[model samples]
Target: MNKAQVVEAVVLAKKAKQLTWESIASTLGMSTVWVTSACLGMNSMPEQAAEKLCELLELPSEAKSVLMEYPTKAWSPAIPQDPLIYRLYEVVGVYGDTLKEVIQEKFGDGIMSAIDFSMEVEKQPDPKGDRVVITMNGKFLPYKAW
Candidate 1:
């Protein structure tokens, strides 16, 4: 099975098993975000994790190999149309320059390394409305001055 097929199988298995990403991650001893990303075919899973995930999801053995394959990391160049995703794009568009300026001032001519990054999503309850909090942690990579 290819990554897309594996992803479809995983999603179906997850729904059929009534498993949450948190539960799956806990069983695999991995972070929820990372586990979800791997299952969704964004990141390659480690051999052990892939095996364990396949076992947990009752997926075919071939899925393990597909889960471990490195992704091409490509996406559509056009702006996403989904509201949630478009909101993220809008946030970046609005804050990109401000974040760039602040980060450069603090860390010099550098960029955050998404390759070495982690993110978490949390919920904060409020009387008005529940709030979603997202935290991203990434390594700062400085530009080579040569």
Candidate 2:
């Protein structure tokens, strides 16, 4: 089966089994963000992770192989259609520079490493409305100079 098919299968199994993404990630001993990304075909899992996923999801042999294969990062040029996704993109567009400047000021000539990052989605109680708190922690790597 194709990668997309595998994702569909896993999603179906998850639904059938009434499994939550958080639970799946916890069982895999990984972060929900990372595990969900891998299950959705955006990332590759190591062999053990893949095997565990296969067991948890009851994935076929083809899916196991597909899960371990490196993924091709592909996306449409058009802006995201989903409101939440578009809003996140807009936030980056508006605050990317300010964030960069502040990070540089605080940490030095460096950038946040997305490769070595962890993210969490939290719910904060608020008087008016509950706030969706997204926390991103990444390593800061300064530019190497000769």
Candidate 3:
């Protein structure tokens, strides 16, 4: 498939799997909107971004190599002119309270930094519920001391 087609496929797969853009974007150290746009063919993936996308989607080596070539246009015509930040905001609208509680529980007072973080997922069996365990490690940056 072509670059746009590949991007579209990845985005569809992500949505089909019910994976959050924030989760994926945090792993890539990129804004959620950029990654979402890149995966939806709304924005071009630079060499590094393409590599990261390939890795995220587990694309084959050959397909990953092909994506590095510059495309004719930087973005697809179908993309809206308005910023995708609104879409991200919509996610917060749905889950903001739950996320805030979880974040506060995990890291105490501060927020998790997408910039300095890593994530790993593993399957764990449980009688109560089938579990998908996600572990995240981010550098904790305390607020400036007074």
Best-performing candidate as measured by TM-score: 1
Worst 10 residues of 1 by lDDT: 68-77
Candidate with more favorable, higher TM-score: 1 or 3: 1
For model 3, residues 23-84, the per-residue Cα lDDT tens digits are 87787788775576556654556677677767777776655645555555453435344666
Residue pairs with clashing backbones, model 3: none
TM-score for predicted model 1 compared with the true structure: 0.97
Q: Evaluate residue 55 in candidate 2 and report its C-alpha lDDT on the 0 to 100 scale.
A: 96
Q: Order of all candidates by TM-score, from best down to worst?
A: 1, 2, 3
Q: lDDT scores for all predictions?
A: 0.96, 0.92, 0.67
lDDT of 3 at 101: 79
lDDT by residue (29-120, candidate 2, tens digit) is: 99998999999998988999999989998888778989988998788889998999999999999999999999999999989997898899
Which one wins by lDDT: 1 or 2? 1
True-structure lDDT of candidate 2: 0.92
TM-scores of all models?
0.97, 0.91, 0.42
